[model samples]
Target: MIKQILPSEVVAVDVREDPPEATLFPEEEALVAAAVEKRRREFRTVRHCARLALAELDVPPSPLLRGERGAPIWPAGIVGSMTHCAGYRAAAVGRSEVVSTIGIDAEPHDRLPDGVLDAVSLPAERVRHAALAGADATVHWDRILFSAKESVYKAWFPLTGRWLGFEDADITIDAEAGAFQARLLVPGDTAEGLYLTGFAGRWLVQDGVVTTAIAVLR
Candidate 1:
C-alpha cells in the first residue's frame, strides 16, 4: 500500500500485526533489553520489517541501532525510516546513490485526540483541513497532515541535524493528487545540488491507516 506512494527505487515492507517473533542481532537486543514486553515487541517488529526491506535492496540484514532522537541508523550506502502503530508496522529503504534520505510514517486513520490537532498544526492548516473534511469525508485530513509533518521532520533532521517543530513547516495537502508539500519555515538545505525550500511527498489513506513518505534524491 505504501509502495504506491514512494519512488520506484525505494523498497518497503509492512505488516498488519506483530510477527510471532523476530531474531534481533546482539547489538539491537541491548537497545531494548530493558524495555517492556510491548515496547520490545514493537521495536522488534519494525526492525524485522526493515531487514526485509534491506533484503529487497540485496543488502544483508544488519543491526539497526537507535540514534539520539530514536531514529533508526541504517547501514552505510542506505537511507531509510521505520514506523509502527497499533496494528501496523512498516519500513522503507533506498540506496544512497539514488536517495539522500527517506522518511515514512503511519498513523491510525482517526481524528487527533481532543486538542492534539491544535498543537500539531498551524491555523492555516487547520482551515484547510476544515474545508477538506467536508468534501472528502473518507480520510482523516488532519491526521494525514500531521503524518506529513512527521515525515518532513524525520527527513530534515537527518540532513540538517536540526530540530523541526510542528509549526516550522507549512504543509499543503492535495487530496485529489494523493500528495502533500511541506514548505520549510526555517532554514533549508541543498540535497544533491537541489536547493530544497520544501519537500514534496506522496500519501495514502487505506484500511484505517494513513501513510506518508518523502525521498530526497542525491
Candidate 2:
C-alpha cells in the first residue's frame, strides 16, 4: 500500500492481484471479438485492475471509456491510471479540481535493462548514473527517475490533451523521505508555467517488485 500526499488531498492505495501471465491487448480494440482468446483474456485483466483501483475512490465504479486523447472517464468524478506486470497490479486516483491527476505503476526489481536511461532519463540525471559506478544508489535512483517520468505523464496527459516524453520533465528523488519531485522543462503544449513543485509518496523495491505512485497537487 502507498499514500500520495498532495497539497490538496491525499490518495491512498494498495497493490492488488497481478496476473500470473503477461497480458496484452489486441492492436484492434474495436474488433475484439475477432481477437485471439488469449488476447481477450489480457484485456479483461486490464479492465479488472482498472476497476478495482477506482473502487478505492468515493465514486462507484462504472464503465470507464477512453477519450480521443486516451484519458479515462468514469461515471464518478475521478481520474487515475493503473498498470500491472506479471506479478503486480497498481492504481492511483483523485477527484478533479480538488486533486489534479494521479498515476501508479509497478515493475520487477532486477537490474534495470542496460541503456534504457537514454530513452527514459534526462541528460543531467544520466550524470548521476555515471557518478555511482558501483553503488546501489545509482541503480535505485534510475528506477525512481523512470517511475517519476511515468507518474508525471499520467498526471499531465489527461488535462493537457498532449503527451510528454521522459525528457520533457526534470525529476528529483528524495531517498530518505521516500518521495520524489518534478519540474517541467519544455512545458510543451501543457498548461504554461504549470510547475510540478513536488510529489511525495512511498516506493519499495524488494523481492523482485518495484511499486510507486504520484499525486498532483494544487
Candidate 3:
C-alpha cells in the first residue's frame, strides 16, 4: 500500500508481522536494551525492514544509529524514512542524488482520541475534515491528516535540523485523488537551498491502515 504512493526509484519494504529472524547489531542492541520488550521488538523489526529496503538499493546492512533528535542516520548518498504502527512497519529509501529527502508514516485506521484533532489541526483543517468525514464515514481522515503532518515533519527536520509543530503546516487533503499538499508556515532549508513553501505528497488508506509518504528530489 505504501509502495503505491512513493516514487518509482524509491524502494519500500513493509511487514505486517515481526521478522522471525530479525536481530539487532551490537550497537543497536545497546541502544534498545534498556527499553521495554515491546519497544525493543518494534525497533528491531522496523530496522529489519530498513535493512531490506537499503539492500534493494544495493546498499549493505550498516548500523542504523539514531541521531541527536532520535532520527535514523542514513548512510552516505542515501535518503530514507521509517515508520511503524500497530501491525504495520515499513521503511523507504532512495539514492540521495535521486531523492534529497523522504518521509513516511503509518497509522491505524482509527479516529484520533477526543480533542486530538483540535489540538493538532487548524480551524480550516477541521472544517475540511468534517466535510470529508460527512462524504465518507468509512475511513478516518483525521488520523490520516495527522499521519501526513508527521511525514512532513520527518522530511522537514532532516533538511532544516529544526522542529516543525503540527500547527506549522497547513495541510489540504484531496480524498478524491488520494493525495495531499502541505504549505509550510515557517522557513526551512533544502539541499537545493532554502525551502519555505511546502511539500506535495501521496496518501492511501488500505487494509485497515493509513499510510503517507513524501519524496523531495534535488
Better of 1 and 2 by lDDT: 1
Worst 10 residues of 1 by lDDT: 187-196
Which 10 consecutive positions of candidate 2 have the poorest summed lDDT?
22-31
Residue 12 accuracy (lDDT) in model 1: 90
Question: The CA-based lDDT of model 1 is what?
Answer: 0.89
lDDT of the candidates, in the order given: 0.89, 0.60, 0.92
From the highest TM-score down, the ranking of the candidates is 3, 1, 2
lDDT (tens digit, per residue) of candidate 2 on 106-138: 666655688887888878877765564334543
lDDT (C-alpha) at residue 186 in model 3: 83
lDDT for each residue of candidate 3 in 4-110, tens digit (9 for 90 to 100) = 99989899999999978988999999999899988988999999999999998889988999995899999999989999999999999999888878999999999
Candidate 1 residue pairs in backbone clash: none
As for candidate 2, its clashing pairs are: none
lDDT of 1 by residue, 1-218 (tens): 78888888899999998878677999999998999988888899999999999998899988999886887788999999988888899999999888888989999999889899999999999999999999988778989998999999888877876788999999999988999999999878644444568899999988999999998876
List the candidates' TM-scores in order: 0.95, 0.74, 0.97
